[model samples]
Target chain A: MRHPSYLLACLYLLSLSACTSVTIDEYQRAEASLASGDRIVLLGRRHSPDYETEPDLINCVGKVISANQSGISVIPEKQFVDELYPWFEPRMAPMRPERLEYLMKQPQVREKIEDLKLRYVIWIDGSTQQTGSAGSVGCAVGPGGGGCFGFGTWDDKSDYEAEVWDYQKQDLVAKVSADAKGTSYMPALVVPIPLLARVQSNACKGLGAQLREIFVPDSSANAGA
Target chain B: MKKQLSRSLLMLSSLILAACSSQLTVKGQFPSPLTTAMPLHGAAYYSPELISHSYAEDDEDRVKWNIQTGAAQQEFFDSLLPALFQQWAGHSPDPEGEAFKLPGVDIIVKPTLSDFQYSLPRETRSKIFEVWIKYNMQLYQNDGQLLADWFITAYGKTPSGFMQSDEAAMNEAIIVALRDLGANLTVNFSRVPELQDWMGKRDSSVQQQSADRGGVQNETP
Candidate 1:
């Protein structure tokens, strides 16, 4: 009974609204996989002179440990016996396939590790580049008592990027790379606040979740015991 | 009446735009750099020469002990040693607000200026500050027997125009290196096992609490 023009307008509105509903497939998969018992290990390394590997690895592992609620046991890959036991020797042994298999077959090792619901190994390698763009704008305000004066303000924008990788089945399963941008406005009368770092932090956290999903498929097959 | 309404609408729009355009600012004052002071000792020693290989030269350059003393070199040490000490002091877990006591019986900062070279390849490489600060610190007795001997290097690069800033840069580099060294020293002093055990217990408790609350049992102790 509605007019044709109204119907067309309604349809247009619906179509426009559809564009805003982002189907975040990555987040959904990560959440689903995490709900099921799946063990994941994070092996983080940095190939840059500026970065320290241990702290970043610890942070990434902390994120993984915090995200999942299942019986998932997130371990640092370096802590595995095959990696640590070599320290006792005069020289470290090379990571041979036979040695790996033997280590995997050990009863104590198998018993403690077999109960792991799922195993996910993630590697993060990236650098942080900080760049900013600034601009100024002027505004006029009428006097509250009589007339208004004018004020100038400055604004800035910052961007960040992260490079990540996931290894599964002893192969490179997936790779995730992301960038985030944010802006900060400083009034002429006030001090400037650094807002870009906050935006970048949020982006990195979101990327972490996305990386989890890409590396771990949301299927019973990948579920931990 | 229509004209008045239009004027009011325009004013409302202007108000909205003004409100949207304005920026929020915060003001705070940081502590003055000078208010905080670092403890100083009378004299520090250095090894004879720095040992480094130059990319341009085939041979390794090693300066002997007696050749490494001067006003310029002293200036370099003045900047470097304090920076290192400050870095250690910042992260030292000796409880905040207490005087910084050297962990060992005697604190000795033994600096070595190795690979000190000034060359001109493209432009004039007037002054290149490359040196290593090796702390041969002993906890007990002043006889140079060290409880901990931390070897750290501070590298500095200066352009012709910025040659004067070399001392400051060297100082900053030494501070960073010493901060790292101090962290290592603290870790070694505390012994990683005790810290690991504490961290493990904390992790276990956290996991247990999470399990009890039925929140998320994803973490393993």
Candidate 2:
């Protein structure tokens, strides 16, 4: 027979483990065929009238992809931004479907991508936000010092999407989306120590791996080596 | 030996009790009616101003419709509404994750819960005991333009004792409101004059097409 204490310990660990996830939802997929000469860039700086750019997440995923160094040439986010700055500002901003179509039809834009051999421009967008929380974690503020106690859990979730535009072909070839929600605990022990979920990490890993899988086709060859 | 045994027993008890801690989550009503009705596309958000006031009204009975934690309240709306809108608008790569933030699409929606009230059930089949949700929503372009603004109220009419026990009716009321909001947006969006103005600026072809069609559709349900 199993010991009750052992079972209890297992249960405690299981609850903690449940607070992280990696979910990959591919909206559209690309051909697994190798594009050896094709260069791809993940556009990290999202063109938004509102909301700050997710530089950390952009860099994290970029680093992950560059580390893989697979078939698709990862052009690096910094280089991609710097190379296309000043120009392509109005062209890349998110707009209506018809407007984007018109943009892709532009002679100057098409020529630029063709000249650069920039086969794919993956527009990446995502953010981490708290979803739901339960219980109560309160605190006090004073001169000597502030202390917080009580137990509460906030649901932190990371959502990411990549729109792969075949700039040369002037078409949106693939779209990859990953969103994960995890609960974070704020246990008040004189101060609120937040056990944040690795939402961004999970999303980054999920998206990076999926992008590689779709574009690179073979991942094991690059694994560990 | 006795003290060690007692400590182990206490540890075991604590672990068992930990599972019983209040596990709160925000849920959404599914299969929005607008999905099939309107084959359109759009984005959604929850403004920080609206999210800043994330509290539900308290009950004298202290029973239903009481969202004690502000974070949980915000999360519930953030996760649920945008996902619903994504499907309703036929948005590929849905806007659930980017709720209340700029979605960078043609049509932008902001859903704010202005107020709500939950009344406990008195009888088994009485409409008197109901939950109400007052929702304020807006649709606009990314370029700081407002298209449509709608203020809607939804009712959750439950005649059951179980439904009213823990503010279940109130949550249901919210779903009702969201469904109505989706349907309204789908039917009424094309009627927004600003959308035509937007189309004129973004794509001249669309404006030409509008002129060729005589005019943009003026019908609204």
TM-scores, all models, native as reference: 0.31, 0.41
Worst 10 residues of 1 chain B by lDDT: B26-35
Model 2 residue B206 lDDT? 68
Q: What is the lDDT of residue A216 in candidate 2?
A: 63
Per-residue lDDT of B102-125 in model 1, one digit per residue for the tens?
453233444443333322212232
Q: Kindly list the per-residue Cα lDDT of model 1 for residues A148-218, writing each as its tens digit.
A: 22333222221222222222233334455544444443323222222223433444554555555554544
- Model number with the top DockQ: 1
lDDT of 2 by residue, B55-93 (tens): 443434333233432343355444434433333332223
Q: lDDT per model, in order? A: 0.37, 0.56
RMSD of each: 22.1, 18.8
DockQ class, candidate 2: incorrect
Give the lDDT of residue A58 in candidate 2.
Answer: 72
Assess the local accuracy of residue A134 in candidate 2 as a C-alpha lDDT between 0 and 100: 94
Cα TM-score of candidate 1? 0.31
Q: After superposition on all CA atoms, how large is the RMSD of candidate 1? A: 22.1
Relative to the true structure, candidate 2 reaches a TM of 0.41
